[model samples]
Target: MNDLEHVKPAAAPKKPARRRFLLSGAGLAGALLVGWGVTPPRQRLMAQAPLPVQDGAVALNGWVAIAPDNTVSVVVPRAEMGQGVSTALPMLVAEELDVPLASVRILQAPIDKIYANVAVMRENLPFHPDDTGNTRAVTQWALAKVARELGINLTGGSSSVKDLWLPMREAGATARGLLIAAASSTWQVPPGQVRTQDGHLFHDASGRKASYGSFAAAAAQATPVEVPLKAPHAFRLIGHAAPRRDSRIKVDGSARFGIDARPEGMVYAALRMSPTIGGTIAGVSPVPVLAMPGVLSVIDFSGALEGQTGAQAGVAVVAHTFWQARQAAAALSIRWDEGPHAALSTATLFEQMAAALDGDDEHVYHSRGDIAAAHEGAKVIRAEYRAPLLAHAAMEPVNCTAQVSGGKVRLWLSTQVPTIAVDIAAKVAGVAVADVELHEHLIGGGFGRRLEVDMVAQAVAIALQCQGRPVQVIWSREDDIMHDVYRPAALARLEGTLDGTGTIRSWSSRGASGALGHQFVRRNLGLPAAGPDKTTVEGGYDMQYAIAHQRIAHSAIDSAVPLGNWRSVGHSQNAFFKESFVDELAHAAGKDPVALRRDMLAGHPRQLAVLDAAVRRAGSAPPGRAHGVALHQSYGSIVAQVAEVSVEGGEIRVHRVVCAIDCGIAVNPNLVAQQMESSVIFGLSAALAGEITVTGGKIDQGNFGDYPVLRMPQAPRVETVISLSSEPPEGVGEPGVPPVAPAVANAVFKLTGQRLRSLPLRLS
Candidate 1:
């Protein structure tokens, strides 16, 4: 008898789903119900539960812990996906705690509301960047409180440093204060007289000294009082090039990704999902797979967990080894019900977008002076741009090791959203949320792919049929690429007018794409999006170009294409549309692209300075190489890039790039530079050769052979120049991505005089 026949998968609870719907739908109504006067402030610095202690380590608070052996550990909730959150965030604590950077270790934070990402949510709200009024403030405040209550622990949006800047600092200072109090009590000295440096407390008066470890036990008992953080000038570790903590592990091959999980007595499972999106398994023949050697059983996982938005109904083949499982799964014959999307294709979706654009369903995001009046008798330039669907293509394929037994489930995976993962696992295994044990590993690459928890749910459902043994379910490269929640195909129509003096007088942008935030909420939170998504019109409306008459509108077309967050979300593609159009206006007006952009930056000093820095550093392209410049701001960071391009035999080769960023303060300059280089490569790959086409409702690309990233030889030499500031640090991970595509497109135009409007820019 098959093990799956004996096991029963629990039905997902309806109450929590209803609660999620109500909470997500309430929006302002819920905020009003809990009046402002009665609303409690979100407590980010406090621990909702006890931090797990190990190896004689005593919990200091939610964010810091110390062992008896002089080892200090700072707990960070964000996932490490090569963006260096594990290293950069610890700098915040180590700076305040006065510990050597090497001496401090990192601990993965537990799933809790306190660890929920408030900054990412607040930044993602629909408010425009220039809207700094009371309405935006109150909405942000109320929503931040709601985010805490909702407690969605996520790591995307480049918000790790920005979110934990204060909390980690205060946790460090609070821990430092507790240590001082402990030393003062033990040595019979005044707390003010004791000073700390390099993890040691010293009193020159009595010639007494003690390591932080020596006072760990006593510090745990002492009441933690608020201590003032060190001024920026007095900072030691922060703003310095602290070597990455995970460098040795990653270089030496010790870092474990989700696919590296190997639990003892673990069975392997290979999944075969439906070929068409939203398709299901109609029937499967398990006898053929069961007769094969090492094949344990064939388990049907269709509708295992109902109401999961992006979940794929599939069949899993369990065997002793992954190769065996893979071969068995491939051998199994199953009839698939392709569903309504069987007739869908990329062309069909674009047609729908075109229809939507033609219709008057466009929702205006931002409006200023009359664009119609400004366009009267003005030099009008109109253009339409298209960006195709894109897959995340993370280095490690989506995999999860899960064990469901005794009304409890344990999961081993690398996920951006741990809380959602836990909830999904519990729901699939028919257990309480508290019964789920999650051990997070370092991600090979996230790029917003791990933000969804459908894989976790699928893994738990597969493990349920394993006779209590852990099952590691892995998706093939083909499955990962084909089944990805893609970056929605986008279309934008831009109309702009240049005045007699060649100044951009009016700008009108109309865009159409699947509502990524809506789909994201449905898949991750089990609810619909509350209001207007800032992501749809981010790059178009939130520009700092000083345009007087501007109107940005987005017509959200609901399509069958599964849409989720790409690296920079809407800015990833919108920058290409906006900046390319700006280039068009410049050329039409007979002005240099860089000089025309400079003309529009009178109000934004930081953006102007960044653009000037890039231009100065890039200089003129040498000989045949032409220069293209683009300026874009995302996630509170401003980035300007100058791409030097030379075309040979219709191939666009980017020789070098000069990038300038004003991300306020750089916590770790080295990490910031790494992200800039990484973003440039990622964005350029998509611009030069990234596309996910669909035919007969099936993804055309299987792996890197078809959907290729930029190889090392193709990568440009990136030079990152950081602007100096004392302001708080903004995001660098994604801000660098939005400018690279347009910069290259604009450069290609300068070189070949071909204004390529579509993505994967091809010259005729």
Candidate 2:
């Protein structure tokens, strides 16, 4: 008898005969929705059972713990995915704790409501990015209260630095104050006279000092006080080039990723999902792999419930080694119900979008004056811009290790959302949410793919049938690409007018595409999507130009294709659409691109500052090179870029890029530069080479070989200039992404005199 026969999968009642194995899966989801309403976020995080700790270590609070060996432990709730978050966030605690940054170590915290990411949800609301009026204020405050009560701890939208800035400082200061009080009672000195530095307290008059470790026990028992945080001028480590904390581990090969997880008695699994998007498992014949070498069993994976169906039914092959499992999976024969998506392709989707443009159901996101009247009186310029669907393609393909034993499940993953991961895994395993234990590891790369919990839930369903053995379900390079939650394909029809003096008098745009947020809310949260989803029109409407009359609206096209948050989300495509059209307006009026933008942005000092710095770095678009300039903001940060290009052998070759940004305060200049460089590479790849095509109701490209990323040799020389500021830090991870594509496209237009309105700019 097969080992899987003994395991009972989650319930998906009323599923087709082929998918009946996932019985009650929908019921569990319904239970989760019911639970979300009654459970407060604070109770979710603070009320969870604590993790087992070391013998001599002590839990100080939700975010920090101390060991007797003089090493201070900081409990980081955010996931680090090569964004330098591990180093940047910990700096906050160490700065306030008054300890050497090196003295602190990190422990990835467990699943709790406290870690739910409130900003991701808040930022996605249908409000203007710069909205600070009563409506925005009330909405934000209400969302914050709800998030706090529900414990929405998450790590996306480049919010780690801003979200934890004040709280981490307070936590550290509270700890420091308690330690000082403990020393005051013991040494009979005034608490005010006690000064701390390098993890030790000093009393000058008595000539006495004590290490933090010596007073750890007493400090834990003492009351905490909210001491004041340091002013910007008094900072030591912050704004300085502090070394990254995970450098040593990553360089020495000791760093662990999701794929590196190895629980004792661990088995391996390789899954083959339905080839068609949003399809389901119709039937499976496992005879081909049942007797293969090292093959333990051929089982069912209840399915991935991430986008349309949310739960994707599939078959899994488990064996002693991953390679063995993969090979066996190839040998098995399976049938699928491709559903309504059986005949879908990108070409067909574009036709639907074209039809939507002429339809009546347009969602007007922003409007000031009458666009029709503005266009009728002025010289009208019309152009159409399109962007193809994109994949996150993180360096590491998705993988998760899980085990369901004794009515409980443990998951080891590299996930951006731990709270959601816990819920999905438990829901799939048919176990209580509290019974799930999540062990988060350093992510190889996230981009935005890891934010989805579908892979984690799949691992749990696979492990549930392994007779108490741990199983690591891995998606090969092919599996990851073909089934990715893709960046929605977008089409925009832009109409603008330039006055006699070459000034942009009016601007209007109508975008038609699948709504990434619309699908997200309807599929993931199981909620009805009402009103405008801000993500669809964020980049197109939120620009800082000084046009007199402007209108931005999107004709919504409901789609079944899986859509997800790619690097910069909507800003990625919308920036390309908006900026390129602005370039077109400049040419129609016979004006210089940079000079034209400078005129429009004269009143916005921050936007103009970056635009000036970028132009200064690129140096006036000298003789041999064509320069294109673009400006956009995301996650509360402004970025401007100038791309220099030259045509060679009928190919557009970008030689260098000069970029500048004002993200409030640069927490760590080194990390900020790293992110800018990374974003340039990411955006360039999409502009020059990134394209995902669908045919025969399936993905045509499989891995890096067919879908090439930017190579090091092809990477342009990127210069990042960061401005100085005293305000709170804003996002840097995604701010740099929106400008690169348009900047390059604009330069291409200047070089060849052919205005390219589509992505993957190819010279015909």
Candidate 3:
């Protein structure tokens, strides 16, 4: 084998340049002081809690630091998994601190409750997007309070920009304000005479100027006080398109992911898990494979031993090389236990979900005016839509490098939740959470897959068996996909009515699927499954359309197949059902899809604006082209999309798409546009080629050969229009996803005259 390590750099640099600010120099007294004791969410949501701050650098609050190089560093708690949080968040600090984007540095912070992501958890509560009552306001506030106390640091649900929008700016402004106060005393000038620009403070009247680094010591000692923030009109960096900080390194192949980590004396490890979702290894005879090339050792792990953590059970093959380890893993003889789900099939899953809709145990997500009374005398419209389960299909398969010795463990990986990763690694290493070090690396892609730390636990477990030798455990692409916690396949039944004059009278929708909120709570929290997951019903009943008698609900069906968040989670499927159904209602009433949405969204100016802009931006499809439109809200943002589709010879082609979104302030407009285009391709992949089918308790397809992704040729031409708003920024990553599928499905019906309800829209 080639010497893969000969040309490589040294093993993971141990704590390269971490520093703690002393109170003597910064003279700051807990400037951004906040605290939270790690209280895992109970049957609600999951987040990594805080660990004690390592004693290296002088600690200011939890974020923001300065070095002698005139670079202002911001400690970002959220993970950057292809999203722009790493850049957008620092912009908030740089913007407030009056520094150039180039002069800023970002530090991926160690886990602490002070940095817990409260927005995603607050969003978990059952509050509709259009809900305006005190119940929603109070409930969100109360949940945020609890999340803060618990210090749950999570980064999913596209809430990174939203959560840190104000706090980061405040941190910058406070630090900057302290500097001004320090300068006020030094130059014998009132604060009004001092100003900051490009990381330098100047007193023009006194003709005195000093770089921020020159006075950082004194500024740290100054008292922290509240200061005014930049108005929307004055933002120079917040709205502007700054180059992504990680783009250069990523493009140059210099960025290190979990797969690149090579600790000193580290060996490669390979795993072969039971093909069945809940299957396990009853026993394994390792003697037969012990003589294989580079074979080190084999360790057994019960697949379900780490419940709620999603750790896969089986045996690990440790070897001198990954290829050697993989080769030996293929020869291991094992006794398999297929578990209770062995008999499960996709057909039976659908049947059971259908039966669940007919059963009495149903969870009502949203109910307003009486549906029975409105349907009694109106023209009823009915249809059913189905979406198949989906896998994350991330570019880099899940992998983790771990080392354990002397009752302490350290993990290096690309994970979305480091705090949770620490906890799970500790649990698997038979140590307390505090005895673990998580060195997070750049993610190849997350899309919610990294939210689960089972792989980390599995790697640490393998490292434990290696006697202090660092082990990097890698999952083959096949193993990653087959054992993935997939997005649930859902079935929705819709019934709506219109008045004699074609005005809407009532709307009722019922869906049968495994509720994500309940499953997350039940699986991650180790508590009783609680009420319905708002995530499941987010795009289902959260529309702001005007319907006097409207009822939207779901029948929670538990499928043996594992389920978790996809790009848009429930909205991914619900949007297709809701938007397509809305188009059907439009056809029944003989109204244009665009016009129907505009009228329904009259009371919601924000929703109406995006809907109108999308339709207008799309304008007339060129000759021989047809258009379809959809509008939906999720994660505190509203989005509208118009898909231009052309069908020929029974094959449907999406030529282009026009999208409009109102996510409050556009922290970075270019990033918003990039995400919109990204989501379009992702959604189209699911609409055209994506599906995860389980038969006899095993995934029928493995890898991209059968589970195809959208390629460059098949990707549609995408154009996006950003709605100008000064309100706090809302979700950007996932909102673009929900509208694309429905838009394409709606357009397909317009061109083919066939209402394709199931996904991968096939026409005969």
Clashes of each: 0, 28, 10
Q: Each candidate's TM vs. the true structure?
A: 0.97, 0.93, 0.92
- Per-residue CA lDDT of model 2 for 1-764, tens digit only, reads 64334323433422111101110111212333344544443422132554345747665566666667768888788989989988998888888889988888887776555555566554556566556799676555545545555565677888888777776777777788888888887888778888889889889899999888888888878775446789989888788877778889999999999999999999999988888876776667786687899988877765333332256667789999999999999988777888678888989989999999988789788787778787886779999999998888888899999998998989889988787777667666667777888888999889888878778867876777798899999999999999888888999999999888999989999998887776665554445655576777778888878888899999878876788889988899999999999999999999988889999988788889989988887886667789988999888899999998988898888889888999887888999999999999999998988888888678888999888899988899999999898889988889999999899889888778888899988888
- Give residue 295's error in model 2 in angstroms: 1.1
Which model, 1 or 3, shows the larger lDDT? 1
Sort all candidates by TM-score, best to worst. 1, 2, 3
lDDT of 1 by residue, 1-764 (tens): 54345223333433333224223322633643365535675777768888887898888888899988889988889999999998999899999998988888888888777888888766655677878899888767776776777777889898989888888998999999999999888888888888999999999999999999989999999975457999999988889897888899999999999889888999998988999987876677677678899998787776675687467878888899999999999998878889889889999989999999999988888899999899888868899999999999999998899998898899999999888888878767778788889999999999999988878888888888888999998999999999999998999999999888888899999999998887888887776665676777788888878789999999998869898888999999999999999999999889988889888997878999999999999987899989999999999899999999999998999999999999988999999999999999999999999999999899999999999999999999999999998999999899999888889989998888899999988889
Model 3 clash pairs are 19-57, 20-57, 20-58, 21-57, 21-58, 26-220, 26-221, 27-221, 113-151, 303-313
RMSD of each: 2.3, 4.7, 7.5
Q: In order, what lDDT does every prediction score?
A: 0.86, 0.80, 0.79
Which residue runs of candidate 1 sit more than 4 Å off their true CA positions?
1-40
For this target, which candidate reaches the highest TM-score against the unseen true structure?
1
Cα shift from native, residue 53, model 3 (Å): 12
Candidate 2 segments whose C-alpha is farther than 4 A from its true place = 1-55, 302-309, 620-623
lDDT ranking from best to worst? Answer: 1, 2, 3
Worst 10 residues of 2 by lDDT: 17-26
For candidate 2, the clash count comes to 28
lDDT of 2 at 127: 66
